[model samples]
Target: MHMADALISPAVAGTMYVCSAAAAGYSIKKVRMDTDTKKIPVMGIMGAFVFAAQMINFTIPGTGSSGHLCGGMLLSALLGPCAGFLTMIGVLLIQCLLFADGGLLALGCNVWNMAFYGCFIGALLIWRPMMKHSMTKKRIIISSILGCVLTLQLGAFSVSLETLASGITELPFLAFVATMQPIHLAIGLVEGCITAAVLVFVYEARPELLYAGEQANTRQNVFSFKKTLAILAITAAAIGGILSLFASSHPDGLEWSIEQLTGATELSASGGIYRMADTIQQATSILPDYAFSNSDSVFGTTFSGIFGGIVVIVLCVLVCRLFKFFSRKKSS
Candidate 1:
């Protein structure tokens, strides 16, 4: 759930920005320390895939809310936590700066709430533990479901806590939490199933990719990394260019929660910080709401999805390359 500027205070936002930055720095260190550079390109492509997947929000039955894949666990399952976190940063940044999907002021909070728990907690605590002794289709399915569900629950709780800490009197803590948790539970279940399917496919294609770092030395290469990347790239293009057109029109879990509480999807925020953040977002958002400024055609939506996915891919690749360069320099 992407938090808007209205739901966060300047103090809370600033604090979260610092916390998320530190987390990113730590992840960068971890990634750089790992010698497997092959994951860099895979991370970039997975980031693009996640960017595209998030565009297609499926409706949650009986809830009047829609939810999309967060892709944190999926990335971690393939790339490990450090790279997964970095990849999510790319996805969130592109969505924030280019599409204005989430508020600029709230970007830090969104990154922490959505990415950190899934990347670290889901991957480390649930997925790895479940797959410790061995890997199987059953283990993958169970871990994916449980990991996704745990992450979403934690993410939802984090959002509620952040909002409450920000002193948003209109949204009482208990009520806001109650609404966010149940809705996201439904969302998590759907995401878990989708994640299991993707992981299963990848496992069949190249099992080594799932636990790359741990099994890199022992596992034989059954498929080329380039081939897997090609398949995923095609999948991303198809999802972003075609399936995004059919996304459910209902509000997402966050928006639905706000609407339930206030009868409106957006709240008014008039502080100087809020105004400044809003102005900057408006200025930078080239494809606001994932469509051209004056156009709402299918072409515009399709173009936005593909273009956004490309942007994420490029940004992630560049970031990974930069990290690699510095890592090499440090070793030298």
Candidate 2:
């Protein structure tokens, strides 16, 4: 869930930003030690895929709430935790700066909530133990479900806790958490299924692409790495270009939860930090809310999806290359 600036105070925002930045720094160190540079393109492609997938919020049955794929588990499964975490940062950054989908001030909270758990806990704790030794479709499905549900549960709780810590909002901790957990539980189930499907496809096509496949690629796969990347690239383009048009119009899980609490999907908070962040976001966001500034034409959403995906891909690739550059320099 993307937190708005209104939900956080400057102190809380700054705290999370430092925490997230530290995590990113640690991940970069780990990635430099990870000799498998072959995963760089996969990181970029999966980042784009996750970015595009997030644009289409699937409706949760019986609840007015909707949710999209968080992609932490998916990316971590393919790229390992360090690379996956870095890739997710790219996705969130692009959404924050370019698409205005998340608040600039709350960017740190969003990254911590959405990316940290999925990449670290989901990958290291759940996916590794479940499927590391024996990679199978059933294991993939189970790990996907468990990872998404557990991490999302933690992420939702973190949101409530962050808000409570911020003290800007009057939402009761117990009630806010009570509402957030269950709705996100539903969202996680759907995302898990989607994630399982994608991972299964990748496993069958090129087992080397999976985290466990580092050693599990003993058997030959039909599709080459290039072929698999090509397929994923095409799928990402199609989803962002075409499938995004059918996204649910309902507010997402976070918005729906706030609406349930206060009967409004958003709360307004005014302060120097908030206004400055908003001003920077407004200036940088060429496509705000995935639409043209003045028009609601379907093309704006389409353009945003494609353009955002490309930007994320480029950003992730650049970050990966930067990490590699430093790694080589250190060796030389």
Tens digits of per-residue lDDT for model 2, 287-309: 99999999989999899989998
- Please give the RMSD of candidate 1 to the true structure: 2.0
Error of 2 at 276 (Å): 0.3
lDDT of model 1, residue 121: 93
Note the Cα lDDT for every prediction shown. 0.88, 0.91
lDDT of 1 by residue, 147-212 (tens): 899999999999999999998548988999999999999999999999999988888777878853
Q: Which candidate number has the best lDDT? A: 2
Off by over 4 Å in 1: 212-222, 325-332
Question: What's the number of clashes in each of the models?
Answer: 0, 0
The ten-residue window of minimal lDDT in model 2 covers: 323-332
Which candidate comes out best when scored by TM-score? Answer: 2
